[model samples]
Target: MSSSERACMLCGLVQTEAEFVSKGCANCQSIFDKAGVDTIDCISPSFEGYVGMCKPNKSWCARWLRIDNFHQGLYAVKVDGRLPVDVVDLLPHYIPRDGSHVE
Candidate 1:
């Protein structure tokens, strides 16, 4: 990953910061937009491993990573950093995939 790359804290979408700023996150965009938070607040440059899911619903790896419900794209196996408290509060049914609260 380059210095300009970032991963979404919730969905682990990987992309350039510029892409995030321009396009927003594929999975968490609406939530972040609704929260009125910037991409920096919900994205991190520090992450470990990445998986490109072509078939999220059928891929065991996607299921194991708990990203089966998410859209098909690049996902960080483990994103670093925590989301802001206000952002976390907005997600009543979301579980952190940032290696903070895994089953």
Candidate 2:
């Protein structure tokens, strides 16, 4: 089984992130561009609660998911039911919550 499963708000299914992305997480590639997110693996790691770099000179962290918290990007766009991605290192579209990501 896949290691982790999160419901694709776009597709509305509890599937692996890869499934969501492969199926088209966001309809537009420009979404990533606008967010300045590295499609190849955006952001770095944050050691302190408020310290680290995730998007080139930007301080962020991916450790949120550890607490079931999820992040969303600024350009929260939806296309053909395709869900937008959060946690791009710019700003969160919504409040971080364990409920954001479905298991």
The lDDT for every candidate, in the order shown, is: 0.88, 0.32
The superposed Cα distance between candidate 1 and the true structure at residue 75, in angstroms, equals 0.7
TM-score of 2: 0.26
Ten residues in sequence with the least summed lDDT for candidate 2: 43-52
Which window of 10 residues has the lowest lDDT sum in candidate 1?
94-103
TM-score of each: 0.90, 0.26
In candidate 1, position 37 carries an lDDT of: 85
Writing each residue's lDDT as its tens digit, candidate 1 over 3-98 gives: 998999988999999999999888888888788888779999999898999999999999888889999999999988898877888978878766
**Residue pairs that clash (backbone atoms under 3 angstroms), model 1:** none
